[model samples]
Target: MLKFPNNFLWGAAASAPQTEGHSLLNGKSATIWDKWFEMNPEKFNNNQGPSDTSNTYEMYHEDVLDMKKIGMNSYRTSISWARLLPDGKTLNSEAIKFYRSYFQDMLDNDIKPIINLFHFDMPWWLMEKGGWENRESVDDFAFYAKTAFEQFGDLVHDWTTFNEPMVHVECGYLYGFHYPAIVDMKKAVQVGYHTLMAHVMATKAFRDSKVKGKIGIILNVLPAYSRSESSEDLKAKAASDLLNTRSFLDPAVLGKIPEELVDLLSENELLPEVEPSDQQNIKENTVDFIGINYYQPRRVQAPTNPKVPAKMPEDLYEPYDWPDKKINPYRGWEIYPKALYDISIMMRDDYKNIPWYVSENGMGVADEERFMNDDGMINDQYRIDFIKEHLEQLHKGIEAGSNCFGYHMWTFNDCWSWLNGYRNRYGFYRVDLNNHFKRTVKKSGLWFRELVENNGF
Candidate 1:
């Protein structure tokens, strides 16, 4: 039998834009997601938009009750910038009221709340003024973060400054998968820099405000592995890791970016100009903890045709799939439970093992009704196996002296994804969209209840 720590945080994670359905209610202005859906509905799977999500905004009381029912001691959710400050300058009283009630309800149910300030839902007004690419947006985000701390600092104790900031930079700026899609390497670099600066400013604000909680940032760390033992392949893996993982991890955790990456960016003239004060602020205000969101490992190989002064990820190394590796047929992500353990050990040995947790780790499946049993409950044994395998590896890491504190699943309920929308469901509760977003606990949900109740498998 595997065991977890006594104070383990058993919970599931959710974000505002993905779970909350009241996108336009009560002075809530448009987020980049809303505007993106309107501009190009075809980009989303099945034309599903944010307006008709799981309706968590209106049904949060019931949702919190469900969380309690599932034996969750903690719940991670985000406050919408667009909802809290609709015009980017004025605070929305209705949003304030809703969030306070939401947090209070979670607390009332004995569930600790972990609130994230930004989760890829930038307000449209901010995006209009160059979003994170503009240095001014850093100050704006700091103001927003301070406002959130002032309003809910007492109710929530665990605050995350940003959730997966790299996704916003890579997807929105370099890959064109998210809102304000632009495939410019310089813009992506700038956006990434400003995001780090914003996090620093927010951390300073949280520290100065004397908030009663810890503040950190959630990073999706995809460990890069070489396809072969060749030095070229190894170099390729290092470069990929520097670009995808260390680009955010080093600065957020160590208060400085990797010198190799900095030199590469400088050589290419893609480095964002860093102000002296920004450097001082970032160096002084590091996070209290780190949130590691591990999904899968990136398999890279020496590029067949590498470019000089590569501008983007694709230009530097070639991505390859390891032979005979298991894959998630539903979402096309590789299943490598060992990657979690590998990351834990890496952090322990190289990164000083700063206190951290598995912030977002789960499987997303499409057309999950096929997994439903005759009793009308989803027999999502696949999800159970996914969780169990990952947990086993996590337990091994813990026993090996990794400073992992908790594990929060990717989501609490079936919610909207950016491009996939509801096509991929990563929720313990099956949501019936046609039936007013009615939720039913799946078999894995029950299994998780037992795991949490017992503190392990």
Candidate 2:
């Protein structure tokens, strides 16, 4: 049996727009998701949009009860910018009341609430003004972050400045998978730089407020592995890692941009305009902890020809397929449990073993209902096995002196994904979208309850 530390926090995470159903209600304004759905409804699976999700806005009290029933000691969720500051400046009283009640309900149940200031849901008004590409967005986001701290800091202690900053930069600016999709390399680098600047400014605001808590940023850290021992393959892997991982990791933790990445961007004329004072703020207000959202490892190989300055980072390196790699058949993602251990050791050795946690880790299946057994229960043994293997690897890392203190799964209930909508389910509790959003705990949910109760498997 593997046991975790006594204070190990076991829980699940979800975002505001993903879970909350009342998207436009209670004085809330439309976010990018709402506008995107309006312009392109066909982009979402089954034509399901963000207007109605799991109805968390109305049923949060019951949801908190469900969390307690699952034996979760902590819960991580984000506050919607569109909900609180509908126009990005004015405060919505209803939104404030709702969040206070929602957070209080969690604390009342003895569950620590870990709040993230920003998820992917940006206000429509802000996106119209060039989003993060505009330098003024840094101050706008800083104001929002300061307001959130002033209002809710007394109720919560653990705060994340941004959830997966790299994801927004890649998907929105470079990959064209999210809202205001623009395939521009220069804009991607600019948005990423400004997002990092916003994080630094928010950290400074938190410090100035004297709020008694830890503030960090969540990064989706996927380690890149070379296809072979050849120098070219190793170089490809390093480039992939620098773009996907270190772009946000180095600035958030080390408080400085990696010189190699800066040189590459500068050579290509894609380096963002950085103010002199911005570096000082970042260097002085580095995060107290780091959040790692590891799902899979990236397998890469050297480009076949002389590299042209590509518009997308992935275009610079070639993706490699391992012959005998384990696969998540439904999701089409490689299932390498050992990657978690490798990442933990990399952090311990290279990142100075700063405190961190597995903020979001889980599998998403296309049709989870097919796994349901008799008694109307979804016997999701696959999810249980997935968690078991990953946790075992995490326990190994902890035993080796890694400073990982918690593990929060991807989500608590099935909710609206950005483009996939309800196609993939990554929740402990199965949400019946057809039946008033009724939630049923899957077999894996019970398994997780036992895991938390025992603090191990």
Candidate 3:
């Protein structure tokens, strides 16, 4: 049987926006998701949106109890910005009370709380003020982070400034995957730079307050692989990695921008306006650790038309599909567990051997009910196998000198996703939308409990 390091944590991650229902209740202001759904109801699948979550707002106590019962040693969940500071400055009393109680429940259950301050849930008021594009939002976010630290720092120790800040730039600004969807490259750069600035500012707040726990950021770190050994393919892979991974990684860990990334942006005339002192701010406020949310590896080749002006990062590198690659059909993502090993190596060699953890990784399936057995429990053996395979790679990484201390699956309960809605389920507990959002432990969950109890399998 494979084993994990001593005192290693095993749990799941969720977010306030994805798991918390009562999106509009208790003085909670509207986030981009809420406003977007209000305007474009048809954009979401199954006509479901943020309010369709698993009711974690009301059910957080029970969820924490359930997590403890399942032998989860820790949990990662974001505190909704809109809910905490609805107007962006004032702390809503009721929202603060609910979050404090929710976090305390985890502590009482002997579960460590890894609190993330933001997770793609932009407050509507801030979005109206140009969101991250406006530098003022940087100050606004710093204030919000400081407030969170002041409020809950004693009860929670592990804090992350943001969850996948790059998605805010790519999906919302450069691509059309999310709300405020626009395809503007220049604005994407601006948004991205400002996001890094906000992160630094938040990190500064965490340090200035001398909070007791580590501060980090969750990045979707998909290692980019070349399709061929050709120079063009190699260059494509480099560009993809720089834009997608290092853009956030280098600054957060090394406290410096990758100079090559700067050159690429400059050559493409896609550079965002940078303040003269911004680098110093970033360089000084690097994170104590990193959170890797790896779902797949990226394979890229030379773009067919590089001569054309680069409007998007995708315009610079073409995606390549490897022959007979394992794929999660429901998510259409390449399933390459070996990438976890490579990523750990990358961290050890390239990023000062910075401490980190597997913050989010899971497979989502459709119609999970079809896997249910007669005992009313879902026999999700596929998910169990998925976790086993990924953990094997993670174990190899740890053995090979990666400073990975823990592993958190994508979520605890099946959450209400952004656009895909409730169609895809990724959770230890199967959430039956058809049955009053009933929660049942799948076979994977039972296996997970044993894994945690043994510290491995």
Can you write out model 1's per-residue Cα lDDT over 1-457, one digit (the tens) per residue?
7989989999999899899888988789999988988898888889998897899988899999999888999998899999998887898999989999999999999999999999999999998998988899999999999999999998998999999999999899988888788988888999999999999999999999997989888999868888898999888888888878888788778887899998878877788878978767877898878888987888999998876777677667788878978999888889999999998898888778889999999999999999888988999898999999999999999999999999999878988988888898999999999998899999888999999989998
lDDT of 2 by residue, 229-278 (tens): 99989888888888888888888888888998887787666888989898
lDDT of 1: 0.89
**Native-to-model Cα distance after best TM-score fit, residue 246 in candidate 3, in Å:** 0.6
TM-score of 2: 0.98
C-alpha local distance difference test of each model: 0.89, 0.90, 0.91
lDDT of 3: 0.91
Off by over 4 Å in 2: none
| TM-score to native of every candidate shown | 0.98, 0.98, 0.99
Q: What is the lDDT of residue 375 in candidate 3?
A: 92
Relative to the unseen true structure, what is the Cα RMSD of model 3?
A: 0.9
User: How high is the lDDT of residue 423 in model 3?
Assistant: 86
Question: Each candidate: how many clashes?
Answer: 0, 0, 0
